[model samples]
Target: MISNIAELIADRIGTMPASERRAAQTLIANYPMIGLKTVAEFSAAAGVSSPTILRFVSRLGFQNYPEFQSSLQDELAAQLQSPATRTLNPPSPGGGTVSPMLEATLDNMRETFRHLSDKQLADIAARLADRRGKTFLIGGRFTDPLARYMAAHLAVIQPNVFHLAGQESMWRDRLIDMGKRDVLVIFDIRRYQNSLVRFAEKAHQRGVQIVLFTDQWLSPIARFARHVIAGRTAVPSAWDSSAALFVVAETLIGAVTRQLEAEGAKRIREMESLR
Candidate 1:
């Protein structure tokens, strides 16, 4: 059985027909929710025929529509799992004798990059490199460290990098200053936060382009995002892992730093002189 249906779709999406590709894109945007809908609803959302939807499912290696829906159902269940519930039934690949975290983390990184397109990475990096616009980063309860980490590197690489910390009220206060040229980088995973969603919605209204870093189950913030990186987060443990997302951040940090090499070097020297 395929461990992640989304990853399977990403791997096979290149060879899919145009109609089937639309179905795949639609499914990725809305995720398991659209897959759980009726065939007519799913097709309408994709702007494709019902047969095309079926063909897309088959390409994903499912026998029939119901089987495809069942897989999505299972994924949805796993996405909603709480830490308490996961501990009761942690995935044990080695019959509980050996830990599977290291292997899982490595696999997560491979699958994440395999699905991530070069064009998507480059487009986002270019946006961050543009010094005219401000960049703001935010995250959920557990993921905010990523926001701060990225913001720290970006602060040196370029100007106008802010990590939205503290309360939701504070985030909203900053929205008034945000406008079309600005970008919001959000890190939200499963059990997504409503406050962040609300903040993203407001940011989008002000014409701020969004970059979202989330798990396989795409966060609602994706609808407003200009770019979305759905990294693999699941592991054989009570809590979901952020290691893959961390690598993603580091990769972007390296990419953006390289893109702004000369300027970044001067900034580093200036920072040192100040110290």
Candidate 2:
């Protein structure tokens, strides 16, 4: 499967020169929107010269700047697609076919992990395993299950793990308890939730360490995030698949469980005794 520009950037970021790396990081933070701008605009935003920006585009396998911008434009369109729009105008005659759905979902999973590095996972896991700070998980309408799933696992492993649910006001009220020692894990995908973006911004201002799980286009929350895992959620169906994000959540749970093996096992044993 062809990797998106975001995925390509992630794959090559480590190998890029300092100037190119800066451009790549800037693009990842702003995502397709920044790439959609003129080359001069992109160069200015990345704090790199126009030639360096062109080189960065070339390194990503685009033949020219316009081609790079076009790819980003296509991704932007895909990112904004609604379920109703997809259903009304399917990508293919057999867009509803089970095989195509499964294939696309599996590809999404493949492409998601392709960009994720071991160091990134280990660092995030280590932070989550720490009992010195609180961990709070929240998600948008479609992705909340990921927040709940991770929270349920982490709660057993340690204390002060919270799954933030309920109204927007409720989420805001909980912010009072958050601070520098706290970590906020937010799961948000495309047609990105404005409420979550606002919540993330507020938490950022309050000094909360944020880990964001979003789709390739990235949620606006990326600006506030300390760690971000951009999964591939698009598929052949009307609804975007959360399968890849679910897998990513499971991977984190496994990593945290391993890190907290003794504590987690003891907690599990104690809970079993209570039962």
- Candidate 1, after superposition: displacement of residue 176 in Å? 0.7
Q: Which lDDT tens digits does candidate 2 get at residues 122-198?
A: 99999999989999999999999889999998888788999999999998999999999899999999889999999
Off by over 4 Å in 1: 1-99
Model 1 per-residue lDDT tens digits across residues 117-213: 8888888899999899999999999999999999999998798999999988988899998999998999999899999999999999999999999
Any idea what lDDT model 1 has?
0.90
- What TM-score against the true fold does each predicted structure earn? 0.65, 0.65
Q: What is the lDDT of residue 191 in candidate 2?
A: 85
Worst 10 residues of 2 by lDDT: 86-95
- Model 1 CA lDDT for position 105: 89
RMSD of 1: 19.9
lDDT of 2: 0.90
